[model samples]
Target: MKYFLLTTLVSLAFLTSCRTLQNTQKPSAGAAHQSQEQQYKAAVVSKAQTAQCVTAKINMDVDADGKQISCGGSLKMKRDDVIQLSLTFLGFEVGRLEFTPKDVLVVDRIHRQYSRASYAEVDFLHQAGLDFYALQSLFWNEIFTPGSRDVRSQLNRFRLAASGDYTSLLLTDAPKLNYQFLTRTSSALLDRVTVDGKTAADQGQFVWKYDNFTTLGGKLFPTSMAVSISGMGKKAGFTLALSRLNNDTDWPTRTTISSKYTQIKATSLLDKLAGMAQ
Candidate 1:
């Protein structure tokens, strides 16, 4: 169960190592080529322009290397501010994961241990371009370009295409990564995002899928998500089913750690995950 909590946090950042689009009639055959592209860019970007905060009770289920565990928790986030998840078992709090602009924090209450590190200090996250805003966008169900807080300004870099029943937004500008976002044409909702390594040395892909949409803060938001990563010689993922979601902004954004808890190196957290999977 401890490992499950830790893995859940890593997957949210590393696994996202991880989309938006909308519906519009196919442009006329003679229409300007970018006409359809422009419409999608507008529709997708508009979905995220208004949301700034979110809070929810989450039922988290994790499956990594064929081991599974279920836990309950709450998730809280404020755009560009913080993202936090609390884990509990048998009505007792056990662990917590928090991400802020400056660093990532993980606490294991049962073990009296914790770790904190800046984004640049985490090798896997840095190599995959999974920063605070990028991970936030993934949770908020928005398309994003690596290192940019807003994807609107970079729409020109994405190639939009409608195929069969889905609209795809593809970005190939990352040094060794390719990002693809897909929306179902029928529902016109951003449903999935995939990141694939471009070189043999960095082989593997991350797939994040959003589902179970409901209205939150007057906007359609996904209340469930499934994140899976494969290749790189290992497979892991987690699913979150959220309930009682609200756009509440009343909670504190930062957590205080006790001096008595042992501080471990951030890299050790990754090693613990690797050990758990084996």
Candidate 2:
């Protein structure tokens, strides 16, 4: 009777081991799907980044009452290089905006005005109510090698949640931004960014819309942008439009004007303006 009991126990153990091995050999379908999705996203980003150069036209409209503005312009972005944007409003020259990893320049040939700033100057620009960090982050991979501490963290913070039919992502910080990126089948792209933070009563909460993305050199870029603030009527919104994109050559930077002094002056000016407006 003892032998019989021992044989029965051995049989049960063998069956249990076989079951474990079978389970280990098979991966869950959900895990496999997720792996495939990750691969696809990596491929999409790679392809989007490799398109040699991108050039497109853009336009911009601002509506405080509507809480948004639309704008479009022409943009040319070279792979792992710089982006040059030529802006025009109503057939009149607005200016040209250029961005590199270390610098940003806005040259207004019509007004013979130029403004230059460095990455560190971003904080100053933000304080001056002229933040362009979004533009910098958008073409970050092209401007830089993409592994620096600043760029790496930024990249990881904003990821491609979905692409193809329509693109969407979740931004890490400032949830009040309520940022959303979407691209249509026709290659048009739209970005809705909200600014929710403590501000003086005059500024209040703001929601900005950057829309009407067009393709240039096979890459998509925003052409129109609008900014609207709470309590301000729609007519008070700001709008900008782009007329041309020059990717055929490089922009001369030897004569670029630094904004170091302007930034300091802007601080005092902003304080005065804030006081007066209040």
Candidate 3:
């Protein structure tokens, strides 16, 4: 169960949290006349103007196999470059999870060890077709296709379905994964994203739900997010309650891992995190 935490962190990036929007209006008659594809395209355009950089202080909770750990954390993201999540306890840093264009790095501060691996070295991530940009969309409150940096060219491949008050866009071309995004039918704000595995080896589900939206950079950004994962006869997930969000981009994108820290295999990262949390 502890090992799956690495998968959970890599797969569940940013999520929605904060104040809910109560007054978003329905589409106009002109918008109603547009095809589902066209309407979705417009929503994509509207959400594309995301923040170039974001920094937030986070209260995070991790639950796995009936064990729960809570910590103070921080989130920092620079668009197209890096996303970093740092965990602390008693005001001292305990662990760090970082994603860059080239690799994923997990630092176990308490153990003075770290693990670094290419994205391809992560099995579930490689199978799900997620990359840096796709994970960036989750953190930045935007929608995305798996392999493409931009979703515009891939619009036609998504199938839309309306159910009750929300619309779902399903990716039909994903062979190893089933990915879906749900948005409010009235305002087109993204509400949830679900990804499920299609095969036995990849038999798990990842759910990222958004709510309590507040305006950031003139956009409706989710300040709180809940992520849940269940698979392989075990369950593990985390929630990030974010505060003090800002567009601060002054920090360096890359962190230099010190030679004093001994490098460890990526597979042992979550084990170290779980032990540290206890």
Candidate 4:
């Protein structure tokens, strides 16, 4: 159970929280006979200029640490700066994660436990060079560095090459993350992201694959996603399918943790995570 919560929900950062940011979509350049580098640069710029999403509702099937769970969830932005993600099973909420600029709040319904911590308090994440925005980029199907808000600068670090139907953008010299972003050449949509990184004692790689693009709110969005993390002395993976998506501007800004739950310290959360990773 601990493994399921930490590996599937916490580590993946699939949860969303408050505030919608403006994303302006620009006209894209046609592939034509442009060089691989040019095509990649164009895609990156186009995605960056695209309008950001407001809210989403997804149906997900999660598997991690040898456990499987099926659930429904919604992603909402409050006040244009905070994002909240809530998960439900059989009409009962089982988990919620709220991400702020400086901290993260996690709730586990099954155990009546909750945890709140900043990025600095999460040693594994600091070692792996991960942050909320890095994971948030995955939710948007964009390439990003953990702490960088500038997507263009992050794209500049990668070398682009044509690989079959996809353009592969790779960052090999990065200290912690060896990253690759793959996008379909025909549609210029992000198809996959694969990155290799490690904690202090464990090395792991995560792959996120996106598929089945459908137009939502005048822009393309993937309808399905498959994410897998391997190594770390264990393997974790999940598949998320979009059930409903909207441009709704209304959503709760805070995750309500009932008084029945006990809030735990961050260290206890880390200990539990380490044991599960092993």
Alpha-carbon RMSD to native, per candidate: 3.7, 21.6, 6.5, 7.0
TM-scores of the candidates are: 0.90, 0.48, 0.82, 0.82
Please give the ranking of all candidate structures by lDDT, highest first, separated by commas: 1, 3, 4, 2
Per-residue lDDT value at 154 in model 3: 79
lDDT by residue (1-278, candidate 1, tens digit) is: 67767676655545534321223334345457678667777788777727678999999888776778899989999999999988888888799989898999999999899999998888778776678988888888999988998688888777776789998887776776778888877655788988876655666678889998999988899999998877746667899999999999899999889989999998897787656555
Number of residue pairs clashing in candidate 1, backbone atoms closer than 3 angstroms, sequence gap of 3 or more or interchain: 0
Candidate no. 3 TM-score: 0.82
- In candidate 2 the C-alpha lDDT for residue 169 amounts to 37
Candidate closer to the true structure by TM-score (higher is better), 2 or 3: 3
Check candidate 1 and list the clashing pairs.
none
Please write out the lDDT profile of model 2 over residues 95-180, one tens digit for every residue: 55576656656554443545556645544334323323344334322111113323333443433444457544333243122233
Instruction: Looking at model 4, report the run of 10 residues with the lowest lDDT sum.
Output: 14-23
Runs of candidate 3 exceeding 4 Å displacement: 1-36, 199-203, 267-278
Q: What is the lDDT of residue 4 in candidate 2?
A: 20
Q: Estimate the lDDT of model 3.
A: 0.70
Candidate 4, residue 263: the lDDT equals 94
Mind sharing the TM-score for model 4? 0.82
Q: Give lDDT: candidate 2, residue 252.
A: 40
